[model samples]
Target: HEAKINGLSITEVDFSTLSDDEAMLKVMMIDEPEKLSAAIAQLPASLYEQYNILQSAPFFLEFLHTDSHKGIGVKAIAQQFGINADEVICMGDAGNDKQMLEYAGLGVAMANASDDIKAIANHITASHNDDGVALVIEEFVLNK
Candidate 1:
């Protein structure tokens, strides 16, 4: 109903038989954060070994293969293009971004990011709405 009111597009699918190879499970736009957290906590510990279960937001959970992450992708691209890891700069503001932020030579968290994100970041910049990306590029990349 909320989606309808907001003119959003969504498709409901039966996931009971979905294979991990076929899909990366995403439970999105959850209305109840506490219940979702409780349910996640109840999941088997062994399941975590096979998947990277990321709570991207208070209401969003994403499950992907353990071997797949933003960090891995960034590393792969850097290696392929002959760009050193020490030359890479990454920024983010969500739990899903944890890996990439950690992998970067300079990890920048948005000022509006969660506490845990800030804890892992090398620096904290302005919020997304305040041109945070531009600021990082100007100061760190352009160095002027």
Candidate 2:
């Protein structure tokens, strides 16, 4: 694979026998995120037509259909459950979670999050290892 040759890790590729119209690839930057970006620029966009590239973390990336994204997924789930976005509290510390965090009514970034992620979050909790999620649960859910 071109990406693998360019220093990325090709984790998996799924192409449905049902129809080649849908396909997806999961890959990792593997400490070479900067290089991966450069390679992407050189590669032809038509290599995978009508696809979406989501970098969930600095090191993790997924290629999916253009119509799909974490933010869209979150919105759909919230709507299905009859919960308004304003009523939800989303917490994250990764690039992939950025859109979802921003779409939520209350976005909480962890203390260990990247500066870019922290900038847009509504609140910042403790680090993941510090039980930051529990802090959210207690403060917003338990109110104790």
Candidate 3:
């Protein structure tokens, strides 16, 4: 409904029901992503439940629960595994990864990542295809 009202298309959803007990999930992978982005940016502040908008992909817009962000999930997992926030190494190259990168002990942005991500990341690595992950592991793990 939010997508519809915002003139965006909800291409795929894994929701079985809209009950509050179940996590309400929605994604808008529009054919016209530029339009969706523009509309979302200009969305009027409403009294509806606040949502965590993630531009996970250039053409994908995922709307998750207000408190459901990657950083929170990463922190929870790190805690469960008895890891400190600074002991976690997170590498990402997209908007959805912003929080995770910021929260990680070693935040690495891909060479292809956006300026926003690079600005917040602790370090920058090669592009994915160039084996950026391998480079980090080699330098931080094998070399160390």
Candidate 4:
């Protein structure tokens, strides 16, 4: 309904009919910034136990699997590829990326990232709009 009011297109699904393999949950894009904050605040407490609530952006509230954090994925991939933890560099700016940032050998936070994120980051790069990730790649990966 919020998507309809905001003139956004989304697939409407009957959640009850979905099996575990068919669906995890729904994603909501709140167009209004103020309403986004309110919606996040009003999220039921029970949802936390079963899901990893992530606000990837100011208006996006992403509810993913509780065990599906980026840190775990990164670690698994590193092990699979025989890479050491100290050889991995991870970059992130959102609260949901906290775990991965901590797990990274060098955690990079964008200049526009929150203070908490910056505090945990090993390095602070430019904002995403200014090609922060690309810069990190150039400096770290390409050694340029």
Candidate 5:
């Protein structure tokens, strides 16, 4: 429905049913109702019930990630880039990117980023619509 509305192609994958290698590079899309429904159907009965309970709770999304997922994602990115986590620089304006930004050597937040994000960043550049990314690249990466 989203793709149809936006005039984009839509592909779906059920991650829970896929092998690790099969799922590794797949761009997981949770925005599609059909795909989400299919993925949810693959969960164990017990886990499914737990998911339902959590879904009804106020803190559902906040509690979704266990510590292991956090560590694994960071480790995987570091390994794939063949660089120490401290050597990387990251910039973003969302809550979900907080961990990645904190792990980077230079974590930059856009001028329009939330106060919380700015607090965690080493620097704050202009907003995306204002070419903040280019400014940062020119001043820090290119000039240096």
Candidate 6:
């Protein structure tokens, strides 16, 4: 439904029946369709077309979700970087950063932050122009 709404072509992969060589070819096709096509031409006719369609569909989808409007992608990045949620610290001046601020072990809202965000943070720091991020990092992260 999402793909249909977005006008994207979708293909489903059934990994159970694919052989090792077929899987490898599929992966290669996804990464480099043109190159894979040239190479596949040298393979048997049945296998050539079998793997060609693999590259014709979208290879990746990006999803964004956040505790606050702006923090949606932040969680994904933290997970990708292998950073522990407890070890992370976040500071922000706007509502979008609210979720990131709350997710971190130490959440500092800018002195200029919205009241709602400030209320949810562990502390309030200086405004952005005053180097709020630097001040908090020095006082809590470095000095600690």
Ranking by TM-score: 1, 3, 4, 2, 5, 6
Ranking by lDDT: 1, 4, 3, 2, 6, 5
lDDT by residue (44-90, candidate 5, tens digit) is 67753432111211111222423323334775788897978777778
Clashes of each: 0, 1, 0, 0, 0, 2
Please list the C-alpha lDDT of all candidates, in the order they appear. 0.84, 0.76, 0.80, 0.83, 0.61, 0.63
Residue pairs with colliding backbones in model 5 are none
Per-residue alpha-carbon lDDT of model 3 for 61-101, expressed as tens digits? 67777777789999999999999998899999988898899
What's the TM for model 4? 0.72
Can you tell me which runs of candidate 6 are displaced by over 4 Å? 1-68
Q: For residues 1-144, could you state the per-residue lDDT of candidate 6 as single tens digits?
A: 445667967777777877766623123233344655465456666653343222222332111221223345667778899988787888876544666787787889888777777899999999998999899989988994
Q: Candidate 4 — which pairs collide?
A: none
What tens-digit string does per-residue lDDT give for candidate 2 at 33-70?
78666766776777457566656666565666665657
Q: Residue-wise lDDT of candidate 1 within 72-143, one digit each (tens)?
A: 999999999999878899999988889999999999999999889999999999999999999999999899
Extract clashing residue pairs from model 2: 56-96
lDDT by residue for model 4 (1-144), tens: 546667977776877887768954445555566888888788899988978887766767777878778899999999999998899999999877877999989999998887778999999999999999999999999999
TM-score of every candidate: 0.80, 0.69, 0.76, 0.72, 0.53, 0.50
**Which residues of candidate 3, in runs, are more than 4 Å off?**
1-23, 45-49
Candidate 2 structure, TM-score to reference: 0.69
Clash list (residue pairs), candidate 1: none
